[model samples]
Target: MNNIDTRNPELEGLAKCPTGIRGLDEITDGGLPAGRPTLVVGGPGCGKTMLAVEFLVRGATVYDEPGVFVAFEETAGDLAKNVASLGFDLNGLIAQKKMVIDHVHIDPAEIEETGEYDLEGLFIRLGHAIDSIGAKRVALDTIEVLFSGFMDHAVLRAELRRLFSWLKEKEVTAIITGEAGETTFSRYGLEEYVADCVIALDNRVVNQIATRRLRIVKYRGSAHGMDEYPFLIDADGFSVIPVTTLGLDHEVSSERVSSGIKDLDAMLGGGYYRGSSILVSGIAGTGKTSMAASFVNAACARNERCLYFAFEESEGQMIRNMRSIGIDLGPWIESGLLQIHASRPTVHGLEMHLAMMHKLVSEFQPDVVVVDPISNLISVGNGLQVRSMLTRLIDFLKSNQITALFNDLTQGGGAMQSTEVRVSSLMDTWLLLGYVEENCERNRVLSLLKSRGMAHSNQMRELILSDDGIHLTEVYAGTGGVLTGLNRLTGEAKTNAAEMRQTQDLDAGARAVRRRREALKATIAALRAEYESELDELDASIARERAQQIALEDDCSMDER
Candidate 1:
């Protein structure tokens, strides 16, 4: 054989068909093996049929490849009606000759044991369906139903092999669904027949919460993701979340976004970095939500879209509460710059919550997202589960270059520095909000625990909330400890009083020194006046002596002149 490049089969006549479903093609390395039979095994209600149908629908609508869907369990009408909620117009596609759905209804009670059983009839029917629409894709929903009437494993295996062979000969990409078994991938162990690619879907419930997951079991000629991915099925249809996207290869931005609190921003070295995950953790009533709201407000003020996920409060309650702190989010909401999604943590499983968040983020395309109180997510999952969910979430947000702020409620009487979810390392900036007890009073304080790639203040600032907004005040650290609230106010008051007394004493002493200087000046002026009078008398005595001697000193006066 000529030198073949087995590593890259796509370039060597092994092309892959794109699924067009969001995130599915990425994990599959470009969807299923083209013109090959791929097995999809899943339990009941685990979305095996849905995945198969979406594959055909996307192929037909997006790739312009007509497809045929052969249903073994449900009728064409039922399948169409079931998928109608997902906006897949099966009837419309059938009318337009883009798709053909042939429901092969099989009743085990009506079947008779035959000497030799085969899928020759199925081949004729499927071949006609494909030729009718020139279909390039085919989906057999629940292959187990077709073979339920046959008890001979030899006949079943032979027929399955023949079926896959026929599809390959026709050069049509196909997906075969089978009921998942307890010990095998399928009840009949169909994984042996369809060896090109295999996918397993599961619907697992833990602690009364349900989550759908998808895993690529094997791909013969391709390098695909091996990790199990969480997928969501809603009105929008299938969305496979690829865990591979959580890698550390995501791009970073040097831009920064404000936190709305000026002093807090100053302490954070101007603001939080754009595309960074920020964690605002604190105890109850310690203004965690307030800080989150302030960040949202700042984002909205910058005319950037913001999404707020509130787990504890309703939208109205959050709006009202934020308005009290001078951060009115109503305008942003009305102006379409903000969206608040409020729900309880018990509403959905951690994976479901993550899926919903992914959906909303994709739809809204917000520049900034805030999740108030991620601690509540712990109610639905354990610590490890919550951390995994958060890690994926943070990774997703960072990959999109979206600034995400998460508020965590740290339990009181525990380590105040740690978070309940235990994902602090995932955050690029961590702001801890807490309260200090001083003088029998509780005062809120905000501290910067960590800020990556910048210089940040380490001092704890008192968190002050007023009608104007949230403010951070410099806290006093004395010999006793950090003084806050009433204690700091009292200390400042005493210091001011002492300074006032000292200033008054200094003013009084300066006044006494001025009075003494004035008395000395008066004494010196009296002494100078007396000296001038004595000098005048001495000049007069000199003049009289000169006049008495004038006659005898006439010649001397002339000489002196």
Candidate 2:
């Protein structure tokens, strides 16, 4: 582990620029180079522009490093307004002479490309902007915009090399954003080879799920995170979550927390370990929320702070419905043991949601956290982002020893079967709940799919909600099978009971037969012993008679013997 000092040398004696984005600096080993050109290449809507703009905004506000942005796409005013939502005061920074934004509009129709044209004019303009603010950071959005008026590949390629060399000579850390092609990263084709560092951004949709990924293609003289990390784009800007290492260093706790349901807690190996994450996955209306609410209430009942982020249901509705199920969240909220944050998945970017979650986790420092239906969050992000966000969230909770419960909604179809199979592999513990149809009745059923580092009962149980709260019945084996719906489970339970009674009757009959056989054996043994005793007495009498006759004879026979 190479620990590079990130403190600012100019102010407090350090030489690093913290991007102000979480999880990104850790991957870069510190941050981008202090005074070198780094290329940001990605397809359209890959957040290339937003990332560059954020770098400048953070530099100006956080580090006091004055910066400049040369925009070849949006207007200066538009750029400022677009990022205003993120709490970036671009106009104020520019007014204070701490930052400068130059919108360069090139018209290909007006210019004639008759001969080789040099980019000296572009250089002069950028130099003037840099000198005006004494900027340490510069961003040239879409450097390929210069190629709009010219078709000559040789001239454009030569000028591209010159532009990179000039930025290095100027000693300013520059970010040159370019439009990436489907086959190659950038349309210019030269940005990849010329820049000191090449970063690629990609936006993809898998199974109707959209996600954004970032990969550091190359970083000269430094080893960086080579994997494609998932990132979110929201009102606060872009945030990347670096994948965590799975090592023995992960902290384990001996403490335990209740599952809210007494029986369920007993089912677990003496309740879930503190800070362990449990996954509750099921089809819709399988009592996922009810189970999660019970857990939250249980935690709060113990005076432990808990956070519930609801992505599917409204807070008011959730609270009201939970009350019907015998969970009183009102008192917990009043006592400040429980907090519920409800929002729409599409309201903001996934990164913003993660930031909010991070913010909440930091502020509340809860002992327990619940994400009501994590699958809904996956709907908003791409598969990679979904996986990435989940991995980070799980690791964060585990590290803090905060027990987390996630509710995942599985679709009820063949297509959903594949998705569930994929998701099941990521969970530490999986609780499957669903509706089963048996005897022309639909009933709720719950079962444990798997639990890591522990032994769990392999039984399909009936789930019942009553005044006593949630209840789980013993393993039910129906005529059809053991893993059936609630009615079938109940039927199976009855069938098992009947079979058990029949088994007991058969055992009693077998015991009676064994008792009869033992009595006959004792009677025969007694007869044999009596007969042998009589025979011995008779033999003695015969000897005595012979002795009397023979005592006269046996006495005579004893005399003769």
Candidate 3:
């Protein structure tokens, strides 16, 4: 969107000059109104000058459009020196004939207010600078100096009107900076209406904390963001972070990614979907960082690059800690598959951090991104800003199809809830990690709170961390409640004893039945043996009687034969 091409038909009627500042082009739908004057009103030290300078510098560098900077309060050398740290080589650009810096000092004490006094000299100088470089952009840094130099309002107003009209006639997009006044957009209260666009910059100390913000007051013939956006002036330049885009229209991925823990993946129904937001909420010492590190390790193991944002712990500290748990992230870091970026939550404002995330993500183009303990951001801003920043971050990651894992630290010992970030609804999977105190010991338990578009497990498992890695175990439940530690062991022992007794009784009963069958068989065998012996004896006795009878009837048998 920042690539506002002059040949682009969509931007023909509404010619937009791309600011090249991060996130500002999206807020403006392209950039400031092209070939028209825009009034930038802000108090002292509110980055108005910086914004204007960056616009011109970026125009010359990125857009290949020449620009001229007309400074009335500061010298050309000072202007160049001030923006040198931003990596803008004004001198180099000037040498290349891409940019022109013309400083016109307007000191009220040195100027003489005479009749028929006009800014013809100033106009001729500005016009000469523009014509010399064929510039398409111009910046008049703090035009309020004109009001200070001229006493008569009518003369200044008429000249200002003519100058603005002349700028439009020149067909060059212009930025006119003005000093903000009490109850007025500008000190003159005229530039705001004279320009086609008006933008307000504010830098205020709220509760002793400084914050810089920007707002688009008006833009003729265009739709622009009206809400106050937090902007940052860092080494890169002015970066406006607009409000998070609201909608669920982002494309989703059917691909699944491991949560690093095998049991956790099973609980999540085969792991989190790609381009999904995962929330790991737990109290201090509940292993939130460990979970996040495990996920990073898993992503790296798959040869996928991961961006790890460490809010509390330093990168080395996190690596060492994970190594203690037998999860070696050293290999991933060495292989360039994992990038651990550590920063204190209070190091910068929330929007600045958000912008930095965007900068890093765009550069790294990682497949997975992890923010360890996002709840620490609550210390930097209110709930709304935190939520907005995270929402935008999630949106950005989703747009890039990057899997996001957020480790959240919350207050311990309460009803299960989302982190202080309060973005549970935006998460695709929410895992609740808390402690279950039993037998004077605290045992960590993990459960799947929410998993969209998939069937997830609802059972709470004992989360055991050892040198081997994460392990999920079934906890013994009894009359009181779920049991763990020695209580769980005692319960298992009693269960084992009962099972052993039942098995012994079954074995004893089988032995008794076998003994009774053996006794009955032996008795039957003895009775049959006795009957056979009796039959043998009775046959022998009959044979003896028959022999006696045969002896007596021998003579009769011979006669009968």
TM-score of 1: 0.86
RMSD to the true structure for each prediction, in A, is: 4.3, 9.2, 5.1
Residue clash pairs of candidate 1: none
Predicted model with the maximum lDDT: 1
What number of backbone clashes does candidate 2 have, counting pairs of residues 3 or more apart or in separate chains? 20
The candidates, ranked best first by TM-score, are 1, 3, 2
Weakest 10 consecutive residues, lDDT, candidate 3?
2-11
lDDT of candidate 3 over 117-226, digit per residue (tens): 88899899999999999999999987778787789878888888899999999999999999897878888885544657999999877544567889988888888887
Model 2: per-residue Cα lDDT over 202-310, one tens digit each: 8876555556788888776555788888787655677787875333246888777888988787677777778777888888888999999998989998989999999
Which of 1 and 2 is the better model by lDDT?
1
What is the Å distance of residue 54 in model 2 from its true position?
2.0
Q: What is the lDDT of candidate 3?
A: 0.87
